[model samples]
Target: MTSLAPSGHLTIGEHQLEYRMIGPSPAEGPTLVLLHEGLGCVGLWGDFPDRLAAATGADVFVYSRAGYGGSSPVQLPRPVDYMHREALDVLPRVLDAIGFRRGLLIGHSDGASIAAIYAGGVPDHRVRGVSLIAPHFIVEDTSVQSIAEIKTAYETTELRTKLAKWHKDVDNAFYGWNDAWLDPAFRAWDISDHLAYIRVPMQIVQGADDQYGTLKQIEIAEAECYCPVEALVIPGAGHSPHREAAEATLRAVAEFADRILNGHGEAAHGQAA
Candidate 1:
């Protein structure tokens, strides 16, 4: 993978976000915008961005949201609409700040749901496709249970210590997501209606053993989305398929990007079962 240093500080409103751009420029092809998971930051992505750039030959852009990594700090107890705000408002500004020409959104977990919302809410022609990994369309008991367990681990185990190394304000980052999900009002949160508005091709990657969500998320995409949808269910993998099954995840994403973004004709409208 080609080495490219992160370009620091893109101010999206009152906050400054840390971001990195790798591989070719927008002039070369559509950029791949990576949205990290609930507890994730740009640094937490490890070498995946580099490997993805190597695999897809498209520019890879990654950033740490407020309070994560080296990005500007945000207050604790974030609003329930945090994900929706990020997708509907902040993400578009980030893209514009970077001068994104055309792109694909590759999002994981919480990030994936944000991408789904963005694609559906925004009528941006630049978004050519979306690749979701372990995305949640609606709140579930399993998801709530898993998040509650993680909160316990954060307080009791070495999880906080480990995460502290990645986030500037670990509590802000942790509680922002935790409190919102655990809030009773968040139970009504769902993005399934947004799927019907998504017109770009989509690829869904999920771990069969994902503790946070189920195939119901993918089923919603297949059922509601008018765009072509492809699904990849990896066995023996859990929540983070890109981490647990790197090669397979990378190949699937790269191939999808090639077919949808670099192909000669419009993507076919069908479901890949």
Candidate 2:
């Protein structure tokens, strides 16, 4: 397949998602598919994708899901199973559309959970491993509290104004994620079953000071996954470790991608599931 442009829109179903491609094409080497956080978009990723591609010597693809960035705006009040739908429905089409031969899925927050679900649910042998930053396996009271506070901030403060620089329809991106999580039915949302079924190595990076979730999220991965699970906890960091601890986060993620994509992946992974 030919290499993708530096940036463009991908028409998936009715949605036209925005994306940026860096480094080699999938045919040249491995690829890294970055799934952004609930409110994150391709623009919000900044130059992290460039740094990652340079560090790993692999293609880096960053995209904004529906309702975020320049992507098509989704209907408000996304389903409680929104992340699940992204993993099982949207992400696969994305990977296929890009002609991804083999690679890693690096995700943040909600994106991390979706990566977990996809790696475990899809039978695609092309995906080598997963790198999760501040992943959520199950909902927590603290998570709810933090999200509520953010909602308050978005509504009363300039958070929406700041976020508007990224999303064309900011309210759709904000409420789509905020409303679903705050919904009472979403409290029971647990994706641990997906963790148990993952057959590839998994690396989880977390912020020690993350208010949205606790170390219990990593504990769940350790308990449920039969595959190798390595945790990297960054001190004095919160929710988005990649931003709070930029250099360290980039190095760690790049190293993990290198290890897994190269022939040494299996040696580090132990027994595959």
Global lDDT scores for all candidate models: 0.88, 0.91
Query: Per-residue alpha-carbon lDDT of model 2 for 123-224, expressed as tens digits?
Result: 889999999999999999999999999999999999999999999999999999999999999999999999989999899989889999999999999999
Relative to the true structure, candidate 1 reaches a TM of 0.93
Per-candidate alpha-carbon RMSD to the true structure: 3.3, 3.4
What ranges in model 2 sit over 4 Å off?
264-273
Best by lDDT: 2
lDDT score of residue 240 within candidate 2: 89
Clashes of 1: 0
lDDT of 1 by residue, 151-216 (tens): 999999999999999998899889988999999999999999999999998999998899999888
Span of 10 residues, lowest total lDDT, candidate 2: 264-273
After best superposition, candidate 2 residue 242: deviation in angstroms? Answer: 0.5
